[model samples]
Target chain A: MNEKPLELIHGEIDGRISATEREELRALLDADPKLREIRSELQKLAESFEKVQPLDPPAGLRARILTAIRPPEKPAGLAGWFPAWPMPTALRYGGAVAFGAAAAVVALQLGGVGQGTPGMDVTGLAGTMARYQEPGPAGDISAIQLNLNELHGTITSHLGEGLVILDIDLTTTRPVAIVADYDSGRLRFSGYAQTDDSAMSVTNNDHQIIVNHEGPQHYAVFFEGDAKDSVEINFRFVADGQQLHEETLKIPLVN
Target chain B: MDTDNELELVRRCQKGDGHAFEVLVGRYEKPIFNVAFRMLGNYDDAADVAQVAFMKAFENLARYNPAYKFYSWIYRIAINEAIDQLNRRKRNTELDEARLPDWHTPEQAVRDTQLSAVMQEALMDVKTDYRTVIVLKHFMDCSYEEISGILDIPVKTVKSRLFTARQLLKDRLADTGLL
Candidate 1:
């Protein structure tokens, strides 16, 4: 009897052997009663384990697990949307004023009250304003840098009133588009506004807002609106419509 | 449960159906709890690990790949949590033996429980990796392929580990005259 094929018996008993191996094992066992005896012993060992009972989980375990997975309790009122970080003194007061002013401006523009605000068309303007207009009751800015190759910048954003405004300070030698990837239906590209720069234009699809800049420039861009708790922005430095440098910033939903 | 059924439940969960996820929790809670119980040798710690594993699974469901069985993916989480619990317990001087609750009552049940306890004692002597494969195969009834996917090990490695583990268990049980 070949002893090497003995391993096949173990695998066969465990249901881990292949079909061809099963045929081989059957032939080996039929020609050898000793191999049959070994198989029976292995089967008894496996059966002995079957006598071991599985313990029942605690009655409350299912409930406890479900409770833990239940979406975290949404923060109450405006407090739910913002991080619980202490706000800077200037931002505390200035943010509230800016938010009020921005909201009023957006409400007016949407109501067709301001036809030529130059930089208030992006739907995110109202959100941007709300984000920084008033000091958030809580939470810190979840920010990421736009550092990819020749580009360098910083983006700081906070959540409030169901929106976030990306306060982006970017300096790049190549023309770059600062894109905000908002969750579908959760966030809207309300509006866009940029500080004095070489040249800038904003366009958007359903999922993202693309800001195109021309030549070397330093600018602070504000993109906002919609009710998403988080946003992911990608900085794509482009030359002749081809992407040269790309970096991504992921902002988690605070709520 | 069929992977297709689980895939449907997972799709519902991905679409934000908390109730569907709760059904999944009910389905998996026992096996996951058992895995932790056998690994940690205590009820409270196992329960804690099981709860954490389910929560982690739900929170990270978006990252779950659909190509693998959901049980394999979730079992991996439970095993990791169990191993981590064991490591944490090792750091402390005293084991919380009190945390193991008693369930035996009838005479036959009592004998079985005692036998199980001896078996578990022998299991504790096995290394964690070996112990894991053994438990997955014998106690959890996981196929070798399932074990491979759950532990992220090659099939040959799984076979080798099981062989070593079975030998060790057989030796330990026989030494105690319980085999």
Candidate 2:
């Protein structure tokens, strides 16, 4: 009835108990009929689990995973120039290189120097400079390169004062949608500006972004959030109703 | 596969050998899928979770510490993903028991399948922490030590949780007269 005897009983069942503890369990079970019944029912329950078969994973699951993990092949022509990812996006979720914090740090370095053109959500070369400039008071600014086909660029981000600054230099010849998915639940997309005057329209619906482009162009999008949040941005580029590339970028914010 | 064999395969994967990773996937996909299915009580969701687990493992291969068993590392990723899915379901109020797939059968076979389904539903009712121990111990056939290492908990805690989980499961099955 006591937790100790029950633990010993489980250890015995799992073959994890010492000989002495095994004896103690056996004696306890012999003395208490109720405990013995409980042990029998528990044994049956465990056996039921053992008898249950392991269902095979959905067919072609291995292929799907292999395709996802396999390095993206360099595209042919202009598209090839912007191949998916040069490497797996290496943003640590909770460490010093956290995604949101690093993005915010990049924002701090920009220091309002690069404002997007009015009516257009594009930041110009100055904003790009601000993005890749020296690290802010947060010590170091983290940069992540976006390699999705037809939308290749770099992102500089950092976290400070409960805000995250994300500067993106996305180049593409076709229409694409970029989405930033955050987990903090408190994430607020308060302000956004861009330098690439080529952006036909930039729309933000909570955590999703749609950026439509006409011809080949270089565009810079800047995002500012008032709340410090750690989030993963799933930048998916879709053209002609087909997904061209996908990458999950982890951002860790400092509150 | 032997530990050395798995490590060698992982090394090949690190060297950008997709085929080698595919081999590893073939080896462990079933057990990982079963682990998710048992924990979450749904086959489609289990499949999705299993795929995500493998993709995540491959994506973070550089972070894989060779100090632990490859299976343990992958299982930890899967269990975390399943727990996350469970949390999401809780938040969305989407825990639908009606979504459980029906098993085809004759009268007797149907009874047996229903019996199994009842057990799985009971498993779904257990708390995630306790269900994890039971799944590792009974479904995956992991040792107490292996379960502890996978969960990053003390072996004593593993034993206690397993005991308590089994009791909870037993109570549920007994109430339904499935025992």
Candidate 3:
């Protein structure tokens, strides 16, 4: 077969040949048995291409993404009585101003400084204690604050021992615990709150606390002994919960 | 329900409405992910690339000219992202070595597992550039023009690539005496 005829046959199999070209190739195939065989081979190859199906993605990818884009806790159930309005308008602008003012007031009280010093520095030591005590109108302690000093660290109460921390350092929201186990050393660290109640413990030579969840969450290092003097736990908040946040502290062993 | 509704959703999404975008994403997510998987040959990479493409499309919805079809715009983004992922994998030696088995039979009574195995091996033997075009054309059933648009290649280039892809497949199969 000539180069042009072979190319035409390929084009026909690929659905790329013009109508006239297809006609020509069809005629040639009808006239020659050998060319017909060549056409069959090309057809098989094309059909084989169709056999490969697209596989499903590994599970958990979608949930991780949706969680990432979720907004701050405005309200839930009957508490969300405010009007839902479209963005880029007067209502959005007004909402933004209102939110800014409320944030400023909270910042000032926590920062331990006057309103003149760039609002409230509601972070570090001052904000940690305030956030722990005040559970907000939502009746949920959205997050916990940890005071990691050079030698010692303080974990604010309200984050119970059984609760697991899935993430830390989230903006304006606390981390949710999907699982918890204290015996296995799976403890919710400072700077986050637990949401889920799932927990497990494994008693091997070295007891391991395994907190299983469908998604990523915060965790802290712990030792297997009641003697706290030999164990030092370091914790940090993560941005996406997958990446560790820059701010971190080591909880010194209480000897 | 139709293209008009889809376009309306897109318009709503462009105005910073997340719900509308989520709806649009829900509608096209499966097909887009399938296309990405076929192009990239890896499930994890395809999912990541598809998600990124949707997010990018959402972020730049205003820049999307209304004259073009929505699928065309979104698909263009997906194809480019898939190709970029393929290239990045090649550079990083992160190409998923996991091979997907095929399911084809000659008797047409039951799918031939053996044939599927042979076909998968044959496909892996072909170069990535050729395999991508073949998958888009045959598996996805994209028209030549659509393929050309997605890949950002001329119509003639699409033809040439498809032709070469077929030739490579035939040669591989013939070597295995599967022809």
Candidate 4:
């Protein structure tokens, strides 16, 4: 038999040889003791290299990440069930003052009146403002309360120059708090959550919103606007001392 | 899962589906983590680097081409991340010269808890270029062509580096009376 190529044999041992070369190398290895010895040595080293066990990640690493990527749970009460009303383009771009003023005008045009219901009373302009002020003092503003029964949904709005959206749909229920500050043209947002007694938070100050949640909940918040401009919005929610669920709306105004 | 199913998962993940990405993570975490841990001697650092690499890969999934192997792409990312981490550690003076022991005897290594750890220590002491070639060839069991694609190096360079790494390892092992 022709002498086997040592390089080809080495390549085969190292998994570098081509198929045809591999076949040739294997045949030669089957016949040669010395070549087999070298191959065995290389194989041992390679096997040893592959046997190292990877260390487990830090206990909280996975939870920390999941918290960051997961969405938040809807606030408990009426707001949870209310469909997220998209902020009007004028309100999102024109500034909070402008948006509020526009909203006032729209409210006036739409009769600027409050209607009452059996479960809750929502009557009179004063009552409407009161509901906006207290949110659920009479437990009548059930629409603004988040439903704990269904924990899957997204809330979207335009904050400053960009859109702001939050997604809350996961098996785990973690209270999430989002705060947005459009004080400047830039938007800032922060998210916080707690999982298994551990708390995690992520903040994007530029976007003016903070997302805070606990557990395996999933959520998202986005902001867009030019730097050096400012807007203001109100975020409201109640927590059981352990967590908070709040949302802030930035109303733009042209000074 | 089937390759077609895996491809679908990748597509869903690229479309910003976190659940889909999570599925992908579950499927490849072990293999990816193994590669990183082998390439990097420390388990903690390897795990951190692997997680970060996977997150980064997911974030940039839009840039991934379906035509290439997903495993290769992820492996490349993990390798690059590990190398970058090593460079950062060197710059920060975090890598201690004292931490690296002289090569051990092959018999000593064999009698040790696991020869992998000894080999790992030896590999860590080598130059980054040589170390990577050795890892791709031995630990990952990658073909020269596959290594070439992942590292963007020519096949000849892969061959030369592999030969150099193996020769150096052999010399070091022999000197330690471990061969």
Candidate 5:
């Protein structure tokens, strides 16, 4: 009846009890018929669980999953460029990226400097930026911190292995959607991930990635950066189903 | 597979090796599927959850920390997905009658033993948190420490939840006269 006796019974059933603990449990059970009866009921519960078998996965489940994630096949005649990630146009989420140029294009377009075009609900990503100047590693870019009262965090870019990554970390009270619009001409959306397990979903295409979630989060958006000229990445933050803020960060290779 | 073997496959997956990922999928698909099935009590939903969990894992392979065992990470993802599904179903008011049949008879109890018996029904009655602990402890054959690691809870909490879940399940079965 006491918590101690019940815990001991579970520990005994789980085979996690020590010799001394076992002896202690034995003495306690010997003194209480109710405890012994309870143990028998618990043992039956365990047996039922054991008798229930694991269900087999459906056949070809593995193949279906593999095909979904396989490397995107390049369309014919596009030898130099691969148009990977041509996702549903219906979910034309925003695309944001400022990387993969021919030179040190320091086009640091923080929000309000010049209103970069917002992502597609109808309008294509358009936004003006300051002239390119800052030299970054592997054509990576960075952005100013978000200014939303409910949302707070900095968005920075890291580049490696032909991928330009946006490391977005934010803590928010209300639900927020981070829309990233990059130059489809220069990059293809590679992947999106949260730093830890959190409630988040991504809508992505070759040019844009939109991440929706609430609470503290560390999100990364990866794109295969392959721009030779100049490309811009615009990050738009939306809340309550409305665009609240937009900023830009890009690194261009002018080589 | 051993930890080293799993780690090697994961490393290959991180580098975009499809074959290596296939091996990892082969190894975990059934276990993950079963885990989801127990939580959802529906094969179709469990299949979708298992597939989606794997896709999420595959997409984030670069973020997989080798220090943690591969199965632990995958199991965590599966459990989270199942919990999310449970919450979504709650929000949508989608009720599975089998889980909560308004009528029950002694004959039905006899016809439906084990998988269809009072234990399965009772498992669904407990809170998701408690059911999760039970699934890990009983169906998954996990030790308290193992459940702690997978659920990312303290070992003490694992013990507490498991004990309470067992009691709750037992009571539900007793109420149905199947104990």
Candidate 6:
């Protein structure tokens, strides 16, 4: 069979043919009775497909699906979801962003990513922008999940562009201050910022940072994770000047 | 939902919002299940594959690219799952070719059963690659471009696959005295 007419036949049946192509198809059918037969057969084929009945999935399938995801499946070593980690190829070329002074820090606060969906107490995600646009190294990903009553989210460490980016996505019931203390010997503090427009104030004094904010917020803190062994950072969660909890994180600087 | 809302739901899901994931599942489960039914031809297998597809989608939400439609991404997952199931069936049965599908349903009108059975057989006769295009185009009501996106193939490849699939279906139907 002539490929062009066959192509046009499918296009016309699919309702994808332009006026010019439809006219071309008509001429082809006129030139050969076999092409007309093929076109007729295809039209009927489509009509038959229209009669394919849709069946309902078995009962309880939705429940089963949601149950499978209640814990949110993760890879073998990680316990939570991390956002916008780069592909290995892209990560290989990632230029780590490093700062001159300070080291790694972990600041605990009450906040969710961008939304405070009830029943789940984890800061969702700060919306990792697409990977190609963000520079990140091809290295290990470490994440910690928090299910605190006041704050729910994940703090994730990603190696990229020669810097360790700690992503904090969370929601807070009240105003919370995140106090972070880092050793200057193992790492360098690059920067920190909230990912979206929410009221926030941050204070840093070389060895410590105190961030005060309220509601759902997402942010990133970058540090030079170039230490030979690992980096540890201490965090103090404070609400209205009272400490709520404390956490310390040790990240192997293995990039 | 609009594209903006859909993207927002996806974003929320990535952020660990179970509600957002449920909303997405509610919106797409029916069509995805139907696509699975058409591809696999067994209601039970279709249900299993559809459920697994959504599970995989949830597990990999973080790696999803926002540049494409969320439905496209999920559809691609569901279709790929269906194909994988088909391959496993082949390996277990050691069949040289796919058997005629049993598409019977208790709710189906008796009048339509013969035609539906014939349609199922014709569908199973086509190769998986072509069967996928047919399911996306005819069952899922997708455009050629949408089909291309779901299959991760060029539009040209989609057209060729659709054409071949239709030709195969038409020839089979003719053999069965349906056309």
Instruction: Output the number of the lDDT-best candidate.
Output: 6
Highest-DockQ candidate: 2
Complex DockQ, candidate 5 = 0.26
Tell me the whole-model lDDT of each prediction, alpha carbons only. Answer: 0.62, 0.61, 0.48, 0.50, 0.64, 0.65
> How many angstroms is residue B99 displaced in model 2 relative to the true structure, after the best TM-score fit?
4.2
List TM-score (chain A only) for every prediction. 0.39, 0.39, 0.32, 0.24, 0.44, 0.45
A best-first ranking of the candidates according to their TM-score comes to: 2, 5, 3, 6, 1, 4
Q: Candidate 6, residue A101: CA error in Å?
A: 58
lDDT of 1 by residue, A90-137 (tens): 332232223323333322222111234444344332211112122333
> lDDT tens string, model 1, B35-114?
98788765546666787787678767899999998989999999998887677557642323322334222332434487
Q: Candidate 6 overall Cα lDDT vs. reference?
A: 0.65
- Candidate 4, residues A1-255, lDDT tens digits: the string is 233465775576666579898888778789888777777766655555556544334333343223223322243543332222222322212222221222222222221111221311112111000001111333221112244532334332322112222332233254534344344334323222111222222333332333344445433332333434434454433233322344454433222
True contacts kept of 6: 0.59
Better of 3 and 6 by TM-score: 3
How much is A65 displaced in model 4, in angstroms? 4.1
Q: Residue B1 error for model 4, in Å?
A: 7.5
TM-score for candidate 1, residues paired by index: 0.52
lDDT, residue A153, model 4: 40
Model 4 residue B168 CA deviation in Å = 2.0
Output the lDDT of residue A69, model 6.
52
lDDT at B17, model 5: 72
Question: Which stretches of model 2 miss by more than 4 angstroms?
Answer: A72-255, B94-112
Q: How many residue pairs clash (N, CA or C atoms closer than 3 angstroms) in each of the candidate models, in the order given?
A: 23, 26, 11, 62, 23, 22
Best by TM-score: 2
Task: Give candidate 1's whole-model lDDT.
Answer: 0.62
**Model 6, A151-203: lDDT tens per residue?**
77766676544556677777878877777788865565545434554544344
Q: How much of the true A–B contact set does each candidate keep? A: 0.40, 0.61, 0.29, 0.14, 0.56, 0.59
